[model samples]
Target: MVASLVIGILFLVLGMALRYWINRRKFYRRSPIGAESFSSYEKSVGIKFIERVGKWIAYALIIFGLLSLWVYSREKNDNEKQTKAVESTR
Candidate 1:
């Protein structure tokens, strides 16, 4: 449970970070001189790459967090079942 909590927190943090990065990139891209100042195709490609990577990272983090939550719930349910069984046996 502790491990799952830690992992969930980590994933949440990572997702937030990725979202921040994506927003920062978007802000710069929309700036008055952002795209206008870039003369090379390579620069555009790099920006696109960054956006894509950030999106993937954010998605992965979300998935990870969800999976962790599922696992935690399952564990909690199992623990509850065990407690109920013990009480009935007593």
Candidate 2:
């Protein structure tokens, strides 16, 4: 649970970073004289890669965080059942 939340936060931060990078890139692209690389410019719209992948990763992490909570609940329930069964047997 904790791990997933941490991972989700980390992914969220990365997505935020991508947002910052995109805004900064746009800022720098205001003039043709800027030194932004060709490949970098090509990815401005997330057409090439990187940004899109980051988005997917962020989504996956968020989903994983939610799943982790469900997992914890199921695990707790199973544990309780096992304990009860053991107590009854004894």
Candidate 3:
């Protein structure tokens, strides 16, 4: 449960980072002050590349988070079953 919960939290953080980055890119494109920094940023790292990577990463994180939840629940259920079996045998 702890492992799954940690993984879920990590996934959520990663997904948020990608989303924030994507939003930053969009914001830079529109905001005049961001134009200077964005141009340099674009030159150093292609805007298109970040856009594509960000979207894919965000999607992957979402999937990972869901998987984590599933695993945690499954583990908890198994633990409960085991405890019940032990009690019954006693």
Using Cα atoms with residue i matched to residue i, what is each candidate's TM-score against the true structure? 0.80, 0.46, 0.71
In model 3, the worst 10-residue window by lDDT is: 30-39
lDDT of 3 by residue, 1-90 (tens): 789978987897888788888887677667555443554755647866868887888989978987897898899999999999999999
Q: Worst 10-residue stretch by lDDT in candidate 2? A: 35-44
Cα shift from native, residue 39, model 3 (Å): 4.7
Off by over 4 Å in 2: 1-43, 46-49
Cα lDDT, model 2, residue 39: 58
Q: Model 1 off-target regions past 4 Å?
A: 32-39
Candidate 3 wrongly placed segments (more than 4 Å): 31-45
Could you arrange the candidates by TM-score from highest to lowest?
Answer: 1, 3, 2
Model 2 has an lDDT value of 0.63
Residues 1-90, model 2: lDDT tens digits: 456455656655665666667566556655667644455655655543665575566566556655665666776788899999999999
- Angstrom error at residue 17, model 1: 2.1
Model 3 RMSD to the real structure? 3.7
lDDT of candidate 1? 0.81
